[model samples]
Target: MTSAPLRWPDAADPVIRGDLTVAVAYVTPAGGAVVTSVSPLGLGERENGLVGFTTSLGFPKKLERILRNPDVALAYHTREHGFAASDSYVLAQGAASVDLRPSPERLAELMRASGPFLGEVKRGPLWDWLLREYHQERVFVDVELKRVAVWENLAARGAKAVTGAAWPHHPAEQEAPRNGTGPRVELAAVARQIHRLPHRLLAYRGADGLPVIVPVKVTSHDEAGLHLDLPAGLLPPGGRRAGFLAHGFQPQCVGLGMRTLTGWLTVTEKDAIYAPHTSKGLAAPPYRTLLTVSNGLLAKYGVWRAQRDGTSARLQALAARRPTD
Candidate 1:
C-alpha cells in the first residue's frame, strides 16, 4: 500500500503563500550546508505539504548538488512587501525532488499564479529573446516538509518545532570534518563586507539532519572570529561547521549584493563565535539594463561551463521523469 502525503500546519499558509523569497539551504557532498535565496513564485499549489521554487538550468551545479543530496531547508523569515501580515518566522525542512523540464503549459500556469506577487511579466520579442534563458530554461524543486519550526517573531529566537510525520531515531552526532577552522578571510575584512547588509543569516545542520537557518546579528569581532547574537534555545552548546550569508536585494533582484562564508562556530553560555573560513560574492550594477546584461553573460558562461563538466548531460537525464502532459 502507498503512504499518505505529508502535510504542514494550517497556520503556515501565510508564509507559504506570500513570502517573496526564502533562504534555501542544501547540504554539500563534504557535509557543509550552503544558503542561497530563491523566490517562491506561484509556490506550486500548497496542497499535500508541497512547496517549491524555480531555478535556471544554466546553473547546473545547483541542480547536481540538490540531486546529490535532496535534504534541504527553506526559511521564510521576511514579511515585508508580501501579502502575509504574520510577524512570525516559519522554517520548513524537507527532501527535494526536481522537475527537470516542465512543459510550456506548466510554465504559463506559474506565470499567471506569480502575477499577484511579482506583477505582470514583460512580453515582446526583445525581452522574450533576452530573457529566454531565464524564463524558458528553468526547472522546479519540490520540498515536502517533514518539520516546520515557528518563531513568535522574525528574530527566530524562542521558537518551537512541529513535525508532519513521526520523528526518526538517529544516533549521537559525529564531528563533521573541519575544513580549516576559519577567519581565513580576515575577521575585520569579512565584517566590513557584510555589516552594511540588513539580512544576516547563519545556516548549520541540525541534530535531526536538516539544515537549520536562523537570523543573526554581529555582536563584535576579534582577529579570530566574529561573535554573533542568535535567538534563544537554538544552536546547541559546542562547536560545529556553519555557513553565513548576508544579502540585500530590490524587487526583480536589481541592485543586489551578497556575501557568503564557510566557518566554524563554537557556542557557550557566554556567547557564540563564528570563524570565517573561505568567502566569495559579487555586487551587481543597480541598473536593470546592466543587471540583465550581466545575467545574460553569466548564463552563457554557466551553460558552457556546465556542458564542459558533463553537468548538462546529467541534468537532461533527470528530465526523463518530466511531465508528459
Candidate 2:
C-alpha cells in the first residue's frame, strides 16, 4: 500500500470558480479511507456544474460483509485550473474499511467542529441555525488509513507522486451498545393540549377583516391521546380581540414552550416542537402540527356574504378573495 499527503486550501481558489468539494470514501475487506478534492463548482445555479466527476466505487454491502471480507481501497483525483499542465493534477488513494453504526453523539460533536469546512457548502450557511432550532441531526462514520498515495502536478502527462502505509485497525475497535434509555415525551398529546387551550384562536378571514375564532372539536383524543380538530367559524367582525384570542396565538400546554406562540402561527403550513435538550436530542418528542386552511371555503363564505348583502364591501372583498390574500 502507498501513502500520500492531503492538501486543503485555506480559501477557495479564485480561478477555480465554484464551491463544490468532492468527498469519496472506500471500504474493502481489509479497511477503509476517505479522499476529498476541493474545486470551485461555480456560484448559485451553476454550483452543480462540472469541476470533476466523483463516484463511490468500493462500498461494502453490509456490516457483516465488511467484517467478513475487510479489504478496501479508494482514491480521488483533480486537475489544475485552466487545464494548466497535466502535471498540475493531484491524486490520493488508500486502503479503507466501512464503519457501521457510528456514534450519534460523537457525530454531532464532529459536525460542530467541521462547521467551518461545511459552511463553505450550500447547506453550510443554514446548518448551524437549523441545528440550534432542533432541526438537524448528525450521524458519524470512522475510517482509519492503511496506506496513502499522492500524485501532484499530474497535470498534462508528467506528475510527482508520494506514498506511505500505516496499520489499519487497533484494539479500540470494540462496538458500543446503542444508547436507548432516555426521557420520552408524547408529542401528539402536547399538540392536542395546545389545541384545547380555551383562549387559543385560529385565524381566518371574516366579514369585517381577519377574524380569530375558537376551534371546534372534531374528534376526542384518540388512544394515542391526540385531539385532532379544525377551527370553527370565524368570529363576528369588528373590535380588537384580547388575551390569547388574538390571531396566531400559540398556547403553552406543556412546560417545554419556547417561542411557542410566534413559531406556531407563522408555521402556516407545518410546525413541529420537541422537548429541549432531551437525551435523544431532536428525534424524541417530535411534535408536528400541519395547518390546512381552505381558501376555497373562505372564498365561499365571502360569496355567501355577498349574496346575503352582509355589511361593508371591504368585508365582502376579503371573504371573496383567496385565503392566501
Candidate 3:
C-alpha cells in the first residue's frame, strides 16, 4: 500500500515577489500528532492593483471541547526565503503556560533559553529596530499544539506573515514623610472653643476628621498673656496659620519699664505683670497705698478695667484714683 500525500484546500495562487516565507504548525490535545503548515506569507503589487493572500483554518466544536477538557496543542510557523523569512510560534490552551518574570536573573535565564528559538532575525539593524519600536530586550517563542490547527489552512496555502511584539512588567515605588512628628493640638477642644468665640473662628476638619482651632492671645508685653498649648490630636493639617496667630499677638502689650502714675508695675518675662502703686522714680509716702486701692477695686469689680472701652480710658481711670500724682 502507498502512503497518501497531505491534502490541502484548493485556493487561489498566492502572489509571492519578496524573499519572505511563512510557516505554521498545528497541535491537538486529543492525542493527535502535531500538524505542520508552511506558506509564503507575502503580498505583491500588480498592474491592476496590490495582491495579497492568507490561509487560515477553523477547528470543529468537538475538537475545541476536547481541548477545553485538559488537552493542549502547540503550533509554530516559519518561512525562509532568500535572506528574509517570518517566524511565529504559539502555545494553545493547556499546551503551555507563562509566569511573570521574577528577577533580572530569572528574566536573563528565560532569554538565554529562548535565544536560539528567537533566531538571528533579531540581530543587527533589525534587532535595533525591534528595540526602538517595541522597547523589548529579548523575544521568546511559545508553541501551541492544539490551537495550532486554526492556522493550518493558512500555512498549507502559503499566506503572508507579520511579527508581534510586547514589553515586560515593572514594579511601582513609594515615598516617606519629611518633618519629624511635632506637637499636635487637640481638635475637639479647639472646635468647642472656636464655636464659643463671638467672632467666627477659621476651622477645618483634617484628613483624620478632627477640627483645628485658631490660637488667641493678648499682644501687650506688660499684660498677662494666654498661651494655650493645644493637644496634638487637634493640630491643623498645615501648622502655618495656627503658628502665625499664636506668635503674631506677642508684640501689642506695653513693656514694664514705661512710667505711669499707678507706679512701676513688675512684668514677668512671660508678659504677666503685677500692678504698681507709684511711678518707678517716685517714692511713696505710703508704699502700699496704691496697691491696696487697686487690689480693692479689682476684688470688687473682677478686673473690670481690662475690659474697658479703651486702654487709655483704663489708664486715665487708674491715674485719677491714685492718691497723689
C-alpha-based local distance difference test score of model 3: 0.24
Name the TM-score of candidate 1.
0.89
Better candidate number, 1 or 2, judged by lDDT: 1
User: Cα-based RMSD of the predictions, in order?
Assistant: 3.3, 28.8, 42.2
* Model 3: worst 10 consecutive residues (lDDT sum): 247-256
How many pairs in model 3 have backbone atoms within 3 A of each other, for residues 3 or more apart or on separate chains, i.e. clashes? 40
Ordered list by TM-score, greatest first: 1, 2, 3
Per-residue C-alpha lDDT of model 3 across residues 1-325, encoded as one tens digit per residue: 9433212111111212322322222222321122222122233223322222222111122222222322222222222222223222211222221111135564445434333322222346644443331222211222222111122232222332221111112111112123322223333333333333221111222232111222122222222212233212222222221111111000111110111111111122333222222211211122233433332333334223323435324333443443352
The local lDDT score (0 to 100) that residue 108 gets in candidate 2 is: 53
Per-residue lDDT of candidate 1, residues 1-325 (tens digit) = 9555666666678877888767888886666678877778638455577888988766576787787668899988887567788877888888888887789997877778777765566677876776667666668898877777777788976636565644334223337465556467777788899887778888877767778888999988997699899987676677777888888777656677788888778888899898888887868788877777676666666666777988778877755534331
Candidate 2 wrong stretches, greater than 4 Å: 1-20, 23-68, 78-101, 120-139, 154-156, 165-325
Best-matching candidate per TM-score = 1
Displacement of the residue 252 alpha carbon in candidate 3, Å: 84
